[model samples]
Target: MMADDGGCGRCCFSFVLTSGLSALFLWLSLRTYKPSLFIQDLYVPGLNSRNNHTIFFQLTLRNQMKDKGVGYANISLSFLYNSTLLVANHTLPAFYQGHAKTAHRKDSVNAAALPWPPSNGTVSFRVRAATRVRSKIMLWFTKSHALVVAADVEVGASGEKVKKKSIKLKSGVADPGSRWLRMGVANAMLFAVFIF
Candidate 1:
């Protein structure tokens, strides 16, 4: 009877240990992990001015997850022109989150003179980032997100402004006929001249 009681006690101890391990594993699996966003590249095409400059905004985001589950990330970009502010583009990516791992991404944009007022052109701009932590979960594996970015800037005028002009002829010149008719007659005359 003593031996039988000892065996039963050992069995009960092992059962409690197994139950505790299972609960811990489940808790870790459902844990949530959040990430970040980044800008990668920026370029300017129509930039040309001495006092005006083109700016390229580059950004990057990095998130290391401690759990494995679906995660969401959002990044919003805004530019400050002189004293005014304008919202640029934004991006979002979703992936799995895991422990001791990182994920990354990037975005880029070129900012110049907008069509609004302030034509005198003392315009300057800067880029900023806003990030958030969405909900996360744990799974059989781990996932991560990392964001990266780079920007190229050029300062100067856009280019030479060309003015339209109206041409005037001497008053004694005869009026020319329709352009289509003149073109047809010229082509016919050229053909005749060449054939003859």
Candidate 2:
């Protein structure tokens, strides 16, 4: 009886171990990450009082996932002067981006909408972008998720962004639903730990 009991205990331990590893693998394989966005470059000649009436910019979109793909809908971009005055608008074509890929979009926009010239050899601007993203897992795609991100741009006497490094755009506000979902995930992870 003692020998049989030892064998049974070993079998149970192996079963639990296999189950835990399988769960971990599934969690890792199915995880998703939202793509990252950044303002790679910005040049506003109007800010420098150059009478150029043009804005040149470079935008960077990155999909950092190692295995999954990202599909973006038409991306709407807007530039606001002094955080309120609309200065320019543009739409970027939608496309599928592969994992670990980065896309750079460059454009020159007419800055006829500038309300006024900058003061003190400096200016403030807001860059906003909105898009819908879908995650491609295996052969299937997930439902579209709305993403809105914005960044503040400070232009100096040179009429270019004050920051030399790329400025990462971030979601301006968090919705209640996503906050609750994150909390729920944390709780579920704790429960799983207790079970294991």
Candidate 3:
């Protein structure tokens, strides 16, 4: 009876240790990161002119993950004037990006009702982008996650971005998927702790 009890205890310990290690690995593999976005160039042709109030923009999105890929759903871009008025909008089609891949999108939209610039010789605008992202692990893709980002842009009288450097867009609010990931990590850690 004593030998049998000792053997059962050893088996339980081995199972618990294995479970803890598996949980730790699962937590690590489930982590996800957001892709980086930058506004490479923004140009307004003949700023608010009658013939051409068109807004042209160049956007660069990079997937910096080393071991994972990113797939983007339809991305909606909105251009706002004075942060209050909508000047133009466009939709980018869905696409897939491999790890460390960079993608550039150049598009133009008509902003017929854009207002004139003030004495600052600069126009203030905001660009907002919304899209769903799927994280691709080794063999399967995670569920679609929502991501929203925006950037403040300043255009000079020359109808070009005031800054020559790329401007990064930041999300005003955290994505639900990110929150879920955090929760998942926390739970996994707790489970591992209990097992150990």
Q: Which of the numbered candidates is closest to the native, going by highest TM-score?
A: 3
Q: What are the per-residue Cα lDDT tens digits for candidate 2 across 1-196? A: 9999999889977877787677667766766777889999999877667567788999999999889899999999999887788878889999999888998999877865455554556777799999998889989997778889999998887788999999998996564336645765686578567755
Model 3 misplacement above 4 A? 1-15, 48-50, 118-120, 176-178, 188-196
Candidate 2 residue 178 Cα shift, in angstroms, is 8.7
lDDT of 3 at 122: 79
Count of backbone collisions within predicted model 3: 0
lDDT digits (tens) for residues 89-121 of candidate 1: 444454433444444444444445455332343
Q: Where is model 2 poorest over a 10-residue stretch in terms of lDDT?
A: 172-181
Show where candidate 1 strays beyond 4 Å.
Answer: 36-55, 62-74, 78-128, 133-196
Worst 10 residues of 1 by lDDT: 161-170
lDDT for each residue of candidate 3 in 1-196, tens digit (9 for 90 to 100): 9999999989988887787688768767677788978899999866645357788999899998888999999999999987778878899999999988999999888885655774347777899999989989988998887789999998887788999999998997776656877787787678767766
Highest-scoring model, lDDT: 3
TM-score of each model, paired residue for residue: 0.36, 0.79, 0.83
Local error of candidate 1 at residue 95 (angstroms): 9.5
- Give the least accurate 10-residue stretch of model 3, judged by summed lDDT: 112-121
Assess the local accuracy of residue 104 in candidate 2 as a C-alpha lDDT between 0 and 100.
92
